[model samples]
Target: MKLAELEVNGVSWSPTKASLPVLHPTTFTVGAGKVLGVVGPNGAGKSTLLRLLYRFQKPQTGYVRVGGQDIWDMPARDAALCIAAVLQEQASAFGLTVREIVRLGRTPHRSHYATSGARDEQVVEHVLGFLNLHPLADRDFGTLSGGERQRVMVARALAQEPQVLVLDEPTNHLDVRHQLEVVSLVQNLGLTIVVSLHDLNLAARVCDDVLILKDGHPQGFGPPQTLLTDSLVSDTFHVDARREQLAPSGASHFSFSLPN
Candidate 1:
């Protein structure tokens, strides 16, 4: 697979509210085989940044590039072949089965009929296995639990065989176990990934690097251990938190408490 560095060059986007900006001249790069977590509280422009990465929204200025080529310059189908996204606002596949939902990832590789060939079916099966989804493959997607649906969405993205996977809040609406499972699954994917997460502890464990954003401005960017400091976390998230290195892994973790 041709995984390339994902780069955002001084991207700044202004929302319809004339005086506000969702992203402010923000720039960062996600190296190949790295997981970069965009972490911040709600309305921190994390989602907006993901949208920019996947070409759902254009920046008022600057650009997003993968493998040194501007994404905007590539054709839609060409871009899809390189980047696959699991977004929060996607339409629900009410009547589709899990296998069929995963098969949608092959759409770009097919004609208008969107039918899958043998190889496509194999790819779907592989994805289903990768996510340990064979048991639920025939179930109606709408009937599955939230975590199951999220896994199906991820499997659909994997069906694309993308070099870079982009996800927005993949763990939302899931229990603690499901959240950890989802993050662990993404960590093992071995692709350049850029995910937006609200949970800093998960960000610290899963992200190779963390980009902090607050009120539409770039706050800081580095290895989570280095940048997710007490000061930065408190200032950006407004929560008093403590950082500690885990016993065996040396991975950092945070404990938060609200100020009285």
Candidate 2:
């Protein structure tokens, strides 16, 4: 993966021609190697927005550009070479092994009727070892626990060797340890990533910049320290959020109370 810039320009989407917009016009930018977190309530179009970024769906009104190229204008295979995404859904383990799942990431790199090559194998092997999935390589993907499965999903995405990775709720369904580990692994990956998160605290720690979405529109966009204020959280999320500094590190920690 290499440094890449991502830009979404006033994008919006609707499920049907006559339906209300699922996402209102919104825009944001991620500089090279920066992590951007998308935070929003359910149906806020977080996933829908990600779909546009990765070329799964095109915005009805605006456009997404990666590395100065419009994603919609790029060929599907070309887009996959630059960007790979992992959504909340996991591949069913039914008959596939972990290694097989990861190896599938090379699909974009393969031409029609082409089989896996030595280079593809090398890439898959390296990603397996990097993510500590080597031990599970031979195991059935379905047998792994929730956290382990998420790691495999991430491994698959990494195997693509993309310049920009988009993940939707990557931390979902994981316990505390795995959640932190996943976030840490993502931060450590020396590439640009756009991820959607439900946990405000985790988003604060992982994101260099945060895009707060409310019913398809941006409520705020900036560094977490500047954007995630008490009033913003209270008004947008309807939670009484308390910000606290923890230990000598002075990192931010937060607690919340429901509105009375």
Candidate 3:
């Protein structure tokens, strides 16, 4: 799939006109083939921002543009064809095999009465391989482990052949190894990626840039190296954060503690 740039220009959303916006007007850009991480505490509107990117929720004030075209102006099918999302809550796929679950991603490209075409099968197979799910292709989806299920969900999203992929809390429940696996997979996907993550260190390692949110407002947006500082973390998360360098790799990492 061709990479697409994602742009959020002054976007904001609210439940109702009178209620305050859950996500205040926010703007950022993810270059084609780059990964953008959205990080914030609960209720900080991280999920709300992601919903706008995948066209699940329209912005109340601004435009969400992908590849320089406004997503809202495009037909929903067209939008789905280019943007795919793997959300925190997945739809139940009881009795469906892994391959069957992945094949459903092609729905946007097919007619209601149409059978899977050769191209559809090709895409599904390619995605299965890309995500290393070929071994589990015929396994019942309900039988997979949490990490395996999450990988399958990612494979399903990849089957859409989307230019932009949106993932919300992709590593929420996985163990350390699985979390690394998922983040590594995302890093090499070669598509524009917008993901919401609670793990700051993972975000620092995987993201090209980070957007920090607090109480539905943007606290900062820039490369994590310079943007994620001790002060910022303390202010946003209310924890004492210290940056440390690991001895073996000399990679930067954050250590947090409760404030006195």
Candidate 4:
């Protein structure tokens, strides 16, 4: 499925009618079936952009659209059906079991207070299996480790079967193995994945394209190989790329030099 161009028109948000300038009235497009990394320094409007996409906050001056359709114009449920998000914050668990938490994703497809039908059950099972959460399906939501909890959140999002999956720092608390597993799974799914990442190397490995946000505006957006150059990494990310060649792997890897 093609990701309709993401159109943003002078989108800005402010509190108390005074502009905070999280996003500086920027406009851009993120293509489909590809992962776009939103990378920037702290407080650069990463989450704000995500909130705008999910309609968690209204824009003061502009609009956001998918498939040429205004995201706000569509019903909230419809938007939910099209996009799922895994944010970088804790969600209060209702003391629900893991299975029950995942099953919540079926809500949009079901009537109010409707039971889980056969297809819904199958989808839930599939998601659990995909995320290797089947073992913890019966566990308490609050008891899982941070990585496990993150995986569960992703599983719940996957259960929505959305065209676009937006994650904010999805690898934050995971060990190396789980981090790789989750990102690789996302890649294999071929969904239009828009995620904010702090790790440039991980972003390079997973995302086909990258969107750099600096000072709450578009710095660059293109293929990783094209946009993730040594100079760009040094300037935009404020880190030096120590380029080295791997003897066995025969590939170049970058290490960051700490700032003076």
Best by TM-score: 3
Write down the lDDT that model 2 would get: 0.89
Clash count in backbone of candidate 1? 0
**Candidate 2 has which clashing residue pairs, if any?**
none
Model 4: weakest 10-residue lDDT segment is 1-10
Q: Kindly report which residue pairs in candidate 4 clash with one another.
A: 3-32
Backbone steric clashes in candidate 4, count: 1
Clashing pairs in 3: none
lDDT at position 94, candidate 4:
78
In order, what lDDT does every prediction score? 0.89, 0.89, 0.93, 0.81
**CA RMSD (A), model 3:** 0.9
Give me the runs in candidate 2 sitting further than 4 Å from their true place.
Answer: none
- Compared with the true structure, what per-residue lDDT tens digits does model 4 show for residues 151-205? 8888888888877888988888778987887787768877777889988877877
Q: Which pairs of residues have clashing backbones in candidate 1?
A: none
| Residue-level lDDT tens digits of model 2 in 1-260 | 67889988989889887999988888999998999999988877899889888888779988898889898888889888899998898756678999999999999999996999999999999999999998899999988988888888888888888889998998898888988888888899878999999999999999999999988888989999989988888777778888889999999887899989
Overall local distance difference test of candidate 1: 0.89
Tens digits of lDDT, candidate 1, 40-137: 98998998888888888988889999989898899899889889999876587879999989999999888778668999999999999999999999
| Residue 118 of model 3, lDDT score | 100
Q: In every candidate, how many clashes are there?
A: 0, 0, 0, 1
Error of 2 at 53 (Å): 1.0
Per-model TM values vs. the true structure: 0.95, 0.97, 0.98, 0.89
- lDDT at 179 for candidate 4? 87
Residue 250 local lDDT, model 1: 78
